[model samples]
Target: MALNNNRYSCPYICPSTHMQGEETKQQETAKIAVKPENILSAPYVPGNVRPRSPKVYPPGAPPKYLPQPTESTSGDILWMSPVGPWAAGHIDWSPQAGITGVRPVVDKYSITRYSTGEWRKNNQFTLTPRATDKAKALEAETQKDVANTFSNLDKKLNHSNEMLNDRIKELSYWKKQVQSTLNGITEELAAIEADRQRLKGACKILMLPEAISRECLELRTGRYEPDLVRDDAEQELIKEVAIVGEIRKIFNDTLIKAELQIEMIKSTKAAIERDWSDKEISLKIDNLNYTLTPDSNLILAHPGVTRWPENATTLEYWKHYCAESIRNCEDVRKMSAKLRADLMTSITKGGEDMKNQANRTNSALAETIDATEQMCEKLEDNLKDNLQKIADIENLIDYLKESLRNVQERNKCVMTRLHNRNYERPSVENCRDEAQYALMAEAKFIKESSESLQSKLREAESVRSELMKYRGELEKDIACKRKSLNIDKDRCARVRAHMPTPEEFAAG
Candidate 1:
């Protein structure tokens, strides 16, 4: 019988038909084969061989055995036979085995099949459909986070823009205020310059050197001269000459008038004495004749008639009688007494009238003297006051002259300065023209500057308005962006809840 290598084998030995007739011989061969080396050399040993363990075999089945094959002498079978289904059924598969030939074919087929089965199992149990959905969800959350961050950045940019606009507005407003203030200062400066020019003109008009000179001359020449003394002296001389001549003429006239009156009275007294003397002599002669005649006739004397001497003249008798009568004269005494009384009365009355006239003259003279004295006193007082005033005025004039000299010196300096400035005499007309031109230029400059300032102020105001408008728009944009950012933040919060946590990523 031919043996098939696929057939299973047991651990028991059986006698071969070919080996039965040779059994006695085989027994001796077996006994010799039983030796240690011989047994080790046997392809299969009998009882000394260890069978395949039951753990590797099925229960109640024979253990499979494999023989070590020898090399064929002929080159007919070059490739080795594979360990078959027994090994396939009993041994665990190792991916490390480099299978070849039929074993490789079987191994590849089994490995393909197992891999397909494992892939199907993993698809079912290890990796679920929810994983793809989770990936998509995570991608969406990342997109949302990106969008929210971008939106927040946009809002920040908008807020920065708004703040810049506000700053620009404030700057523009301040620029306008500064421009206005500058314009006001410029106008004030112009007004001050105009006032200064006016004051300069007024000073020029009022305090001119020529006017001061004329005034000084008038004061010095006209006001404080001693006019009263010369005038009074001239008047007094005229009056004294006239009054003294009049007084001398009156004295001479009065002396002549008194002399004529005294001479007339004396002539009249001489005539009266001469007439009395002539009458007394004729009366004595008549008396002598009458005594002679009467005494002779009376010789035969009556007893009652007184006796006279024979040589007694009538004149002597009469003379004696007259002398006796004159001695006892009461009539002449009463007449004399009456005349003396009249003369005394006339003289006393006349003297009293004269005395009253003299007294009035004296009083008039006293009044004149007092008036003259008072006038002199007043004049002296006036002269003294005038002299003091003149002295003061002279001092003032001296000071003024010194001042004028100083002023002249200063003017000379000024003139020298002007000359240096001009290099020649500057004509009044030319100076006036230059001044007017300068004033016109200044006025024009002021006007133009004012206009420029106004224009600048207007421009500043316009810029301020534009800046304010920009600020307002920026504020609105900031508000809108902020609102959008707030909405994005809310959406980002919602997205964050489903996304992977930072701690989960770390763990993963």
Candidate 2:
């Protein structure tokens, strides 16, 4: 009825459009507001409609999975990945040898300080061929080269030995020839030696016993060397023979004349023997003095012995006889000695050369042995290094193996987690519903809490205003009290100043 009554009274207002000014006022005056009897009551819904229950989960149901807030998974590892990471490994077996090894010498060998199985990590190490591998690779070439070198050394040694052996034989042959030539040229000396030997045999026993020989020499003379006793013994025996000759006389004239003649001949022979011995001794002495090649050649040219001319008288060759007999004798003795010395030097030269050759060969052999032994030691040390390297490599292998196992275990763990993520993810609709329900509950809680907080905030503002007023009043009161206290303090100061000390009061 009100709407009927107001319908004509109100100006036309566009129901879909907003009104302003007179139309807005007229619309307001003509408005038909339909309000229910109770503002909080529900509308008369049909009996067929059911009331909505509060959002609550069914009892004992699996909890909905709270969705992980999706990060920018397009570039992130929000989800577990099935793929395993690529792992790398390395081993350091290269030699880091210190000042450590064996050093062999002729009499003794020494070893440097040694350390073993010292392992360390390095990023710079790269793969290289093992020693055995490298050695195997070069085995044939090294063997061939070594064989060639050894063959050369052996050939040189063999050649040297052969030359040395042949040279020894040649020197022996030359020595024999030289000895034969010496014996042949020394005929006069040999004759003198024969006479001395004959006289020695006739005077005493053919060979004097060493004790008797020593007595005849060392006891009678100062000290006769056994080696030179033959000369001394001969002199003693000759004197003994002379004593016998003087004591023992023959009665027959013819026998006596023969005995005297025999004595004259023996004396003459003794004189000749004496002269020969002097010459021989002088020759021996001179033999030691010649040193130069020219001197030797001179000795060879002049055999140093010139026999006197048998038919020449001193009157026919006076100057030659007088000068040459004495001078030439001296010259002959010197020359003979020089010639013997030269012969001896020449004879031994070949032997000395052979000896030098042998010495050189031995030296080379020794050097080669030393070098070979050194190489052997080096090879052995290499082997030891290789052993250490292999042991360290084994440790490295174990380390890598452990690392690989760890990586595999980690991968398995990750893959297991990934598999669980794939299999165990909750339904998206259930999750979303649960989330929305939770959000609605949260929103209601926030609204209630916000209203409560706002009320509390208003109360706090009133309390703050009251506290500020009280604070202002307290500040004014404190200022008044401060001023009164200052006045009291001034009056107390005046009273204290007027009051005197006890001594001043007494004096006054």
Candidate 3:
């Protein structure tokens, strides 16, 4: 193997060199990935570095620190960048030095693309470096947003509390009003009870039934006595008068007829006596007819004689005297007989007629007397019946009047009982006063309760007003924050669109 060393030499590449080239490629890829981070960080322009307060811990506490990788190698690269502590800090895959190197590459490329007009002319994805003044402005904007959020929450809480309080006050006021109304109703009921009791007491005071009974009895006794007696007496007097009048008329008629019959008898007896006297004188003249003397003719020529003889001794004169005497005696006898027969007939007929008339009159009188007696008896009976009826009617009337009086008295007693509440026997007026006072007290209670409820209601209204004000303010703040957040989202979308995709530059 040592015969010719130069002629046996072999051509082979080094694996270390290939591996170093692959590392360079990987570094390039990593650098490209870090470019976006560098651009994101570059936009956060460094302002004046202010001293920040370190986190404080309690006694016996350990210091909080982020972890770091201990191993190191030549050309080693990190791909992930660390985030801030406030955002839950994570380790960066790329080293801090590598980020610095890639930052210039990313900036250069971004500038070239912008100049060539390959991106949007507005360069919305390009994160401009924030100046010191701009950083201050962002901090102020963040503080303002926090303050507005807190203020809105406070307003909402206050409005809810106010509404709750107002509702409680309204409930309390209504409760008082109800209590007052109940009190008034109680007073009215008490008044009604008092009135009822008074009326009951009054009804007991009047003893009307007994009085009515006594009055009725007295009226019954007196009602019929006088009127019935008077009517009976009047009827008796009328009957008596009628009977007396009829008897008087009959007696007068009988007396007139009897007197006329007696007068006719007396005239007939006188005419018979005159005829006998003339006959007696003529017979005496005939017995003295034979004696002739001068004085005889004178005697015959006397006024008592009928004629005077011319020859004093003539025989015809005597004969004529005897005949005349006989005729005169016969005529006297005939006249006497006629007078006797006529008188007897007149007396008998008159007596019979008178007796008949008397019997009839007596019978009629007896009948009239009997009728009068019957009338009297009937009048007496009628009087008794009328008296009884009148008594009954009067009794009824008296009973009614007494009953009316009793009712009135009872009513008066009821009134008295109603009034006098303090006394044993109360009057209507006294009862009414007690009832009225009770009612007044209840009314006062109601008024007071109502007033209290009204005051509470007013307070509730005031609280509600404050709550409404707070709600209005909260609504305004929320609206403003929402509008700001919308603007921020639009800006973020524009920036994201400007970012390049990995596949766009990858080798096929």
Local accuracy by lDDT, each model: 0.39, 0.37, 0.39
TM-score, candidate 3, is 0.23
Which numbered prediction scores highest in lDDT against the true structure? 1
**Which RMSD values do the candidates have, in order?**
81.7, 84.6, 83.7
Error of 3 at 126 (Å): 99
Model 1 residue pairs with clashes: 287-314, 287-315, 288-314, 288-315
> Can you write out model 1's per-residue Cα lDDT over 34-58, one digit (the tens) per residue?
3322122224446654544432223
Ranking by lDDT: 1, 3, 2
Candidate 3: regions farther than 4 A off: 1-310, 313-320, 415-508
Where does candidate 3 have its weakest 10-residue lDDT segment?
112-121
Q: What is the lDDT of residue 67 in candidate 1?
A: 15
lDDT of 3 by residue, 1-508 (tens): 0112222222111113334465466556545544322222322456633555553334553222211122112223422123321221233212222323332113222321111111221232243454698789998999999999978976875675566555445434433443333333333333323322322222221112123223322222342222222232233333433433443344344334434433433443344344344434543443344233334544544475566776465546644653454444344334434443443343334334433433443344344435445544555555555555555555555555555455556545544543444465346634546665765555455455555545554555555455455545444444433332232223322332332222211110
| Quality of model 1 by C-alpha lDDT | 0.39
Clashes of 3: 20
